[model samples]
Target: MLVRINPASCPSDGHLAALTGERAFCSEFKYRRGMEIFGEGEDAEYVYQITSGAVRTCKMLPDGRRHINSFHLPGDMFGFENGATHRFNAEAIIETTVRITRRRNVLDAMTSREKGAMNLIGFVTQNLQHAENRMLLLGRKTSLEKVAAFLLEMDQRQDHPDMMILPMNRRDIGDYLGLTLETVSRALSILRDQNLLRLGGATQRRVELLDRDELARLDA
Candidate 1:
């Protein structure tokens, strides 16, 4: 579940290495399924990269209801913010490994290198685009459309074209799509009834899309 690394994967050319020293590359950790990586309002000490598995960033309402914002899979970076504390909590949806770099070290690297600043800007910009898309999904899309969009997005992340493995559950899906769990379940059932998808098991990890065209149309 939890792992620590003294030296981590870095750019081979030693460019980033020269800027951040070997010590900066330390502190990689692995989290168990449903493990909390960081808590809301916790000090923003480091930024993380998903080395394996998946993570979900979410927030809780005053009444203790959770709303999942997004899911991050391998190669995705998260927990990077220009603030003293994290705005949301990050938890592993499944077993996950993440590489971390101290916030101060990252800032120092950016300060010394224009390219570093640019790269950080680009990362933030991409995240902003994703957030904007989610906002649109939440504000305008119907329940069916939202589920369709979620499926398509998950499909893109999958390795096999014919199958997709969802890491999170229906409740998490509902929260992310701005629907209730019953609504999410109903939409998925409709998709199945229409022969658009075949669910593999109760976990809903394996799904085969039988009608991508129809699914795409639902999003329109």
Candidate 2:
């Protein structure tokens, strides 16, 4: 099921262009849920910034296991790469809209090579930081800790402070957090039982953090 995202105020075209950082070079595109935005090993010709929906960056192993690297919400950027081809696959987790700019167009539109390079470095560093955090979560965190950290991370990303309408399923979460499906479900149930979080809505994708401090402790 798709989770509805309600932005406080929608931005105009001008604002969107500014947000994309490519101005006139940017074009809008929409993708249906489960659509492949870009595939692994494809040419990294364009960079994308989410306009309103969620997306996921993933990798498929030789044995056919899927590993989700990151979940991108509105305003998050993806597809920026230093290499000629994308290292991982990118897919729309929900109905999505994005402002996309071709690599050559972005370079041509830049005022200076220095500024463009700086911008690229910034994006790379941001991505690196997230990757580092996720590495820690997977390498050292216990199942409960992993799930707690995932919730806190998603809580911060979602529009609401205490509530989150998760765009992905438990299986998706498990893949991202390096946990099994049963372990993910069990962790969530444990959190709910401890009164640290509450599952709401008919679909139960709506999660409300009832005790953030306690949850933080668990994550810690």
Candidate 3:
């Protein structure tokens, strides 16, 4: 249920247009790293799809700790809400571009041609499923297990060849994985030392999973 909302008529755009029967219904916007896309408690008037880079959706707890609900990478959608207002804040993790359309327009368009509403259903289902899985993973997993699971999740989502490029940094990964930044780094270093994976690139974001089965065993 990903939406690649490029302004040009790419294959993703064509697929969406076929579903909604409306061509060129969305507009694109760009945000710099750390820029706020939308804030918590704001009106949920639109739906957004990332064109490039990444965005983090999060909320602050009473203790001032931020818990990240999810990350939206290129070709993924966000900004859907159950109520009139947004429950969490959304910010660009890097220089990112996103296409957006009015929620009402989406509903009206679905009412017409895409009676299946499979896109919306699938999107919502995945969101719920991810949340449920994270609740368990965060509650009981050790630092090594959490980081290993994180790598596996990113590998599945990004579909890169042998190497996985991470867009977010250590602090962002810590926030999402419920660990301290040092703990995240230490876990990755341990995995690299064990030859379960190798971290490369100038920023060390390029990750090659050497033994996915071992990572899976730890995750299990």
Most TM-score-accurate candidate:
3
lDDT of 1 at 101: 75
**Model 3 Cα RMSD, Å?**
4.0
TM-score of each model, in listed order: 0.86, 0.85, 0.89
The C-alpha stretches of model 3 lying farther than 4 A from their native spots are: 1-24
> Which residue pairs clash in candidate 3?
none
Instruction: Kindly report which residue stretches of model 1 are placed more than 4 angstroms away from their true locations once superposed.
Output: 5-24, 111-114
Q: Which sequence of candidate numbers ranks them by lDDT, best first?
A: 3, 1, 2
Compose the digit string of candidate 3's lDDT tens values, residues 1-220.
2334355532335234534554536877788888888999999998877778999999999999988989888878788888999999999998898878777866787776645388657667777899888998899999999999999999888884498999999888999999999999999999999999999999899999999999999999
User: How would the candidate models be sorted by TM-score, starting from the highest?
Assistant: 3, 1, 2
Worst 10 residues of 3 by lDDT: 9-18
lDDT of each structure? Answer: 0.80, 0.79, 0.83
| Stretches of model 2 off by over 4 angstroms after superposition | 1-22, 108-120
Number of the candidate with higher lDDT, 1 or 2: 1
